[model samples]
Target: MNALSIRSIHGRQIFDSRGMPTVEAEIVLHNGVRASASVPSGASTGRFEACELRDNLAEYHGKGVSSAVNHINTPIQEALVGESCDDQWTLDNKLMVLDGTQNKSKIGANAILAVSLACAKAAAKAYGLELFRYLGGLQANTLPIPMMNILNGGAHAGNNLEIQEFMIVPVGAHSFTEAMKMGTEIYASLRNCLKKKGLSTGIGDEGGYAPDLNGDEEALSLLMEAIQLAGYQPNYDVKIALDAAANEWYKNGHYIFPKLQKKITQSELKGYWEELCQKYPIYSIEDPFAEEDFPGFSELTASLGGSVQIVGDDLFVTNPDRLRQGISSLSGNAVLIKPNQIGTLTETLSTIRLAKEHGYGVILSHRSGETEDTTIADLSVAVNAGQIKTGAPARSERVCKYNRLLKIESLISGSEYPKK
Candidate 1:
């Protein structure tokens, strides 16, 4: 029953896509197997989520994470070395206590999450189990539906559009592979569609084209055209999803659409989404209000919850307490899970379980700024979340998760996805 004990751990500062320094942690076992994991940074972060440590000095323009790296290398490493890496909870608990804060403020979520995930990788490797199996046991068999974001706006894009992400969901596909094919085809058609319109193909943070469009309706029009161009029926073969990420552009107390050159109140925002649902084949809306606007979420969900998904990203941030509060307020019907937002694999899994137990849908998501780590792919499968949002089918970092899912689908040949 015994194998290799965790021998050592270390961390260092690394650069993320935005040329900002982030944390990367390495864990080594006694038998020489080693694993290293890096945390992804988010461009549009929630106000309530765990803090991502940054040096306020001139270096990296106040985005440096040398403090986090040092935290991992010294006290955290000293406490974690010689512990069983397989005891993910115990390890994460140590991290929680060491930080001794609600949001991991003392040590930094960036440092703790990197070490937590790195130890998970090392444990799985040392135990000779695939990461999914290691985390989910035998029930980790189903593949998730891909939510491919093909258009970018708001904080994630340089364009003036208010909505942050415009995605295509291939929900009608029978299998994960087929669903991925549908998304890729639509993505390609969208590229050609942009070219025909004399629009630039320069992509945003998540690899979707960031064109200067006037409003959200233009995005819906382009997506429908792309689906038709790819030989698929709108709302049948593919459905539209929007991540408004409204908190990013929420100024003072009003939601502003610079592209539309207008500002809207809570009732007006609700009317706008209702109109969108009527005009387009929209299936989901994320962060339709600011993080603190629970009543807005409740009213919108009550009116539209019967028809489509109302997801909370900034509203929940994958925190159990926030999710619990959301459940009480009827804030959202679904939640977006980002591990870094909560700061540990154990906490992330707990949050997912909590959301699912309450009949809320779970959307495993990727950060706007990311690395080549594909752990989120395995975690998605491990938890059997029916949906995942890992950006578009461009860039090596974004595509790596999709490619890992492809390989995983190959491994379980006789399995049927879409879970009964």
Candidate 2:
């Protein structure tokens, strides 16, 4: 097959739940195949809202978005204008060379993510397989791993800040439908459990009260509660995890540091988390502290590493040098992986391998600003990363990935991929 041609490029708003402009890119291949990808705006109007990296990217959005549009439409487009769509990697690398030094910029990275996703999606369509199947292969299919969320249980919105979010997924369901049914049942049960404890519906932004209702903890809680009510145990077949987003913890000198420190003690903090683990069976915690607090993270990891995984999101930023430092210093035992963090899929995967080599569990995650594209789901399975943390299972943008996984499960009934 000759190189594939790119026909068109455009951007569209996909998610606006939190009021930010998160957008997705649509790219059409020469063969009339359409593919898309989203870049979450990392900007934050509030402390507890979505990841701020997108906001950082926002500063460069115009340039980044334009460059990405051109990257897929320019050199690569020319190289593959009339060629077959096979050999995507070679064409992708050729495009990389055209990008040259500009690739180092955030805009460059955005361009790469958009282009790579479009290419991958095109390839998946060509094979008549789900993107994950193309990326992870049939042999790697396992039970649909369980998932939970952390939306409340923090100091935000008058909540305790003592409890973290979590979810439980059954591992051996026969099909996606069965797994979803189990998830739904678990969510219902959890709702009842919370109601028995006098908790409200826990549906809206005000229901679960984390320090930042708009924060990662709140999102995580919502997901966890949803999973629990569906009739699954948190952290059992359904692995429990949090997306702290580095908001609860702050830099030592941040203006609010003193006030934040006074609200929760180290021992009290440990006790709170310990109790959460005891009651909910949590398996992972991400960005438990401020990004700069490597010592604090190391302490937390060393203290709880035996029973639970400590993950780094802001801590690593998808930089290998930082990851090396993290592993060497024992700052944390896991890393949240995001392609846009470092710009290229290859670079992102390299970080995953490095984390794995160091015994760190890798979690493929989504930004608060997300799109319909679900490439990360496939990336997680392809790399054999243990988990994926998007958001509450309620949102279409978030659940779309889960639903797609279910579709894939339907096609290959007996694959090893986790069922529930």
**Evaluated with TM-score, which candidate comes out highest?**
1
| TM-scores for all predictions | 0.97, 0.74
Cα lDDT computed for each candidate against the true fold: 0.90, 0.58
Give lDDT tens digits, candidate 2, residues 1-420: 332455555554344444454445566766667777765544212231222223335544432344444444555456545544445566456545655653344235555566556667776776676766776676556533545342444332244443334434355455556656675565566556555656554542212223333333444455566565665555554656554444544444441323234455454555655666676556677776666667778888888888787888777877677789899889988887877766556567678889989888777876555666678777766776746666556666667777766665566656554322
- Across 313-382, the per-residue lDDT of candidate 1 in tens digits comes to 9999989999999999998899999999999999999999999999999989999998888989999899
lDDT of 1: 0.90
The TM-score obtained by model 1 is 0.97
lDDT of 2 at 407: 63
